[model samples]
Target chain A: MAELTCQQCQELAAELALDVLPGRDRAEALAHLDGCAGCRETVAALTATADRLVELLPGAEPSAGFEQRVMTALAPPPPPRARRWRVAVAAAGLAIVLATGGWMLGRASHDLPQPETDAQADVRTVMFAPLTTENRQIGEAYVYPGQPSWVYLALDIDNDTDVPSSTVRCELVRRDGSTVPVGTVPIAKGYRGWGGPAAVDRETLATARLINSNGHTVATAHFRHTRRR
Target chain B: MRGVHLRRRPPERLPDDMLLAGLGAGDAQLALAFVRRFQRTVFGVALAVVGDSGLAEDIAQQAFERAWRHAGLYDPRRGSVQTWLTSIVRHLAVDAVRVRRPAPVDPQDLMSLIATITDTPERRVLAGETSTELRTALAALPPEQARAVVMAAVHGMTAVEIADLEGIPVGTAKSRIRAAMAKLHAALPTPRADHG
Candidate 1:
């Protein structure tokens, strides 16, 4: 096809910027634009103004729960294991100064901060464990002891299948088999990353199991019982 | 004063890019804040284009989801978070309206929009200086040009489609759109980098 002349291109700039120019004319104008600087400048300025036009629309509040709904549609989270792996590989690569020990385990320890910082405070660090399904690891759970206690969760939704919208339940099981609910979190795509502010009795949590929305246990992180250690 | 200590700002206080990062990383609180910050603007754009509240809501919701999904790709150098998001919601809204087919844009709706933007102080504030200039310029245009530009820009109507809607020749439709855009372009405080 013959390229559009500069006059033709300039005439089409407004429609091109608006993105309403017909396909053939658009192609010709763009072909002309590739070689013509002046036409390009005109098109660019017009395009910017067209986009800024949307900003001028008056805002209107939608019905309530829209925020909640949008949250439910959040991006796929980076799984706890994935996050640890990232920190691990990054640490291992950066562990040049500390190569006296196994780079792997030392980097893995970075996942837990201040394990012995406040031992006399009566807070326990019963588990900083990875949650795994029957076939492979999918998430990680942290049951760090504190005044109230805290739980951190990282889960990948695609253990063997893709179920990003599945809501995963985190429960801390006690010695008596009674369980405390950490919280129900929605996973998008394959990963979820959440930090601890969940107030629970860390000393009492004997096991951490991730249950899918269907009430079936999907992954479990066996707590390293303090006595067993 | 001795016991006072610095603390991290709340999620609501974080800049737009930070919230978007949190949204991409799937931090629930940040995701909620991101939604809260832009929900009304997204919904309004969607509603204006589609002119159906129910469908607009769906498109708005989908817009958020898409933004979350692709938030990783956002670049600050291209535009502000609001501009990036406005483009997303606008595209989604335009696509939704297009699917409804043969969209006969009401001149009244476009006129009402112009009136709303120029008359409402909050809307002007939301738009900022450059956008406010464009809004005022839009409000100042001849009614035919205002309707023509809006139909093409917001609804993604071609000149032929607009001509059909207004019972005018395609050349007349193009002239109106071109004239309105030239005026709006002149109103911009500074020529912005093109996003398209």
Candidate 2:
């Protein structure tokens, strides 16, 4: 095996500080740094230099409400046991009410043949930014209260439309107006295609918005949830 | 009112280390101060990487929250509060950028930032004497090498991405960045231990 020299170590150390070292070289460079104090100091100095360069970029003030958002995210998690207790109590009360209503209805309509159960599943679709006759937005989501939900979204664009090469990102907007990033897909700028089949975990679905790389809202669709009767 | 007056002490301004410690202890006011002190740098780094203000805001928020949560683990011996916080912001921003391809940044973008800094206190400090030194050092490098280093440092562009942007070969791009860093390391003063 060829012994790694000091010059080679210095070169790799620079790459390590920049974070552009190919993964294949990372192990060898790290092994060198493990035993070499001088190289370690050099890497640290380079890292410090790289960090100061961050000061050069023009600063952008965060939008209004950004501080509030950070504070909210850092707030302590609410007591889940209490929430669960409340939900259990509500479910029990609902069951009792349904039983009583069934008993009352049976007594009143014994002669009437039992009505056919409404077995149809409700599916909802929404459209956002129906800009032109040729361009439209359509989406559908299936959600069950306690399980992960799946979604599908599509955007229609006029063939003549000119869009720069862009990627699509989708967010799951909950009823309370909070959002969770669901997924992202890359496609041609003007290419019309479906955005997801993304699985959503937390937060009840309220809407999904497709956004471009420039943060433009290409289209949005509202979701309506219905409980089985 | 009398009890409140008796209990109140003047809000003594603490140094950055104390403020960081307070943030770790969940001192809300200190957390706010920390955020205010560093938000510009955090937001600036995020904007440089993602190139979208809204997305940059999200990344900055995450960076601050992460810093606060992990403040207990911060060891001043390793680096300064600013250095530690900058690392957090850079990590988040780079991850955000690497996961997706953002709009390509033009070299001309550097000129816009080079415009004489004004408005914010932080920028004033950045534009002050230290930046002059940094600018001089940057000027000493070949223009192509300087641009490549800036692209790597600011935007967290890898060698391959720099090659694509600069229309150079990947091997050449990598060498340029490595060579640039060596020159910069030689040029800049070793950051003071005070930064730790």
lDDT of 1 by residue, A63-177 (tens): 8877666676553342343234343333333333223222111112222232221122112222466667774666556554433345666554544453436566878788789
Best by TM-score: 1
| Docking quality (DockQ) of candidate 2 | 0.11
Model 1, position A154, has a per-residue lDDT of 57
Give the candidate number with the greatest DockQ.
Answer: 1
Interface root-mean-square deviation, candidate 1: 17.1
lDDT: worst 10-residue window of model 1 chain A: A101-110
For candidate 1, write residues B96-173 as lDDT tens digits. 776788766777776777687666467546866556566678879898898888888888898999989889999999
TM-score list, all predictions: 0.60, 0.57
Q: CA lDDT of B115 in candidate 1? A: 80
Q: Give the alpha-carbon lDDT of every model.
A: 0.67, 0.58
Q: Against the correct fold, how does model 1 do in TM-score? A: 0.60
List runs of model 1 lying over 4 Å from the truth: A75-229, B1-6, B120-130, B192-196
Instruction: List, for all models, the DockQ compared with the true complex.
Output: 0.17, 0.11
